[model samples]
Target: MRLNIHTLIHPTIQKLAYEIIYQKSHKKLQNTDNEKTLGMLIFYEILRKWLKIDNIYIKKVDVLKERRLSNQLDKYLIITNIIECYNILADVQRILPEPYLKHIDFNNINNSFYCNEKLQEYRIIIFEKFLKNYGIIEIINYLQKNNQINLNHVKIICLTCNSNILKYLANKYPQLNIYTIKIN
Candidate 1:
């Protein structure tokens, strides 16, 4: 089944929310020196539009009653979405680069180093979502089904934090030797 973009957008927003709030620490007014707020506002607006949430104006009194109240609300709405987006992006980031075991021509594996041009411009949100949901096994399966690789000879190197995923891969593809490295 095709992935829903709206489901993807929420997580992307959440990821950005963490980046903006925790990583950047916009608690102090000085942190707002750059266009960080503006960037966040734009992202919020995009998410609002995608989720079909109506825009509501916040009056000066409302803004004064709680400093950064708007930012806080945006953070809450986007956090879940950001987590989802990060997962997808991480997957794309993991596989899009050259020398993906399944994508490489095994005979020329030592020399081949090409990126998939078609996915080069994936939006950050979509890419993050892919990482969260699609693991090496799924990628290998996709390649095998698409005739990009022979499943019989495929070896999987999985660096995953999820033990359940490792167990699932072990059970599903016994023919393919799987080595997993623990990720914190």
Candidate 2:
């Protein structure tokens, strides 16, 4: 399975996830079991709220079963949940068509600025498209920098909190090399 945290979240769920943790701890970024729990909860909430998927829960996933059996010794087991969720989403698409719904592939490029000289020209245009795709109007309440996205600013980079954005943009614009600095 692709070990990515991007496609696993949407902006609304992200706010809810953070709020779930914020109520428990003041420091938000502390990487602990609580943080992991919040992540799991967000995945569940996405299925429950966003997709109207109630019958399936995170506990039902086999990889999660393995993780629970092993007591989560390997943090990588978290990846299993995201993959399972994506599969669920794909199943939904096959069942009902949602307008403008972007099929997410976690492995796709999010937003990256390749310094390689050979890719410079292509990068310039792609970088611009990336900026537009993720500009303030798009992800303003999410990752858009302080209510303003300056494409003319030159130093354009995306540190995506969720990989779904990358997958959506890539699917929409296959020609442009979507770029992002992966956190993990």
Candidate 3:
């Protein structure tokens, strides 16, 4: 069962939607700095593209409109930023079993990070969707901020689609644990 990002009813998407709702209701997360709107737009845009009924659903919605609409599904949505989006993906990847991961197109998604507390390790996962030029810069910035993480315990995982950036990072930081996964 290959995971399709465009399909609303796909297991992966269903899981994502359920997680969003659960997180929203349980945590009472509110939108901040327009990030949530942008995230929601990006998310739904991907989900809406393949749906035949998408044409009939509300075409455009602003923050106020979205707030006012407050339909059942809308009420449960957990609005988030890019980092949160990455965190959500990491959570899903961690929660789902290995077999499910193989079928999901993780490479197509943007940047995300995962921390394995059991191993005391951190993984910075970069994808093709990330900005090619600034990807290394962003990672460097994150590393600088989170300096507590020992360099030995930090792993940089890059999709083969960003091989150039991976090569540069690996060469520049020889001590860093860098690995690449080729996605077809």
- Can you give the TM-score per candidate against the true fold? 0.26, 0.21, 0.30
Worst 10 residues of 3 by lDDT: 70-79
lDDT computed for candidate 1: 0.32
lDDT per residue as tens, model 1, 8-78? 23454445444444533345432332224323433344334322233455568546332321222111111
Q: Write the per-residue lDDT of candidate 3 for residues 70-177, one digit (tens) a residue.
A: 122211111112343443334332221220111112333244533223221222222222223544545454454544544444433332224455455555555664
TM-score, cand. 2:
0.21
Question: Total backbone clashes of model 3?
Answer: 0
| Candidate 2 global lDDT | 0.30
Q: Per-residue alpha-carbon lDDT of model 2 for 1-184, expressed as tens digits?
A: 2222223345654454455335434744433444444334433443332233223325654554322122121111011123323322233323222312222223343432112222211211111211223332232122224323232211222223335554554454333222232322
Q: What are the lDDT scores of the predictions, listed in order?
A: 0.32, 0.30, 0.34
Error of 3 at 179 (Å): 3.5
Q: Rank by TM-score, descending?
A: 3, 1, 2
Q: At residue 42, give the lDDT of candidate 3.
A: 35
Which one is best on lDDT?
3
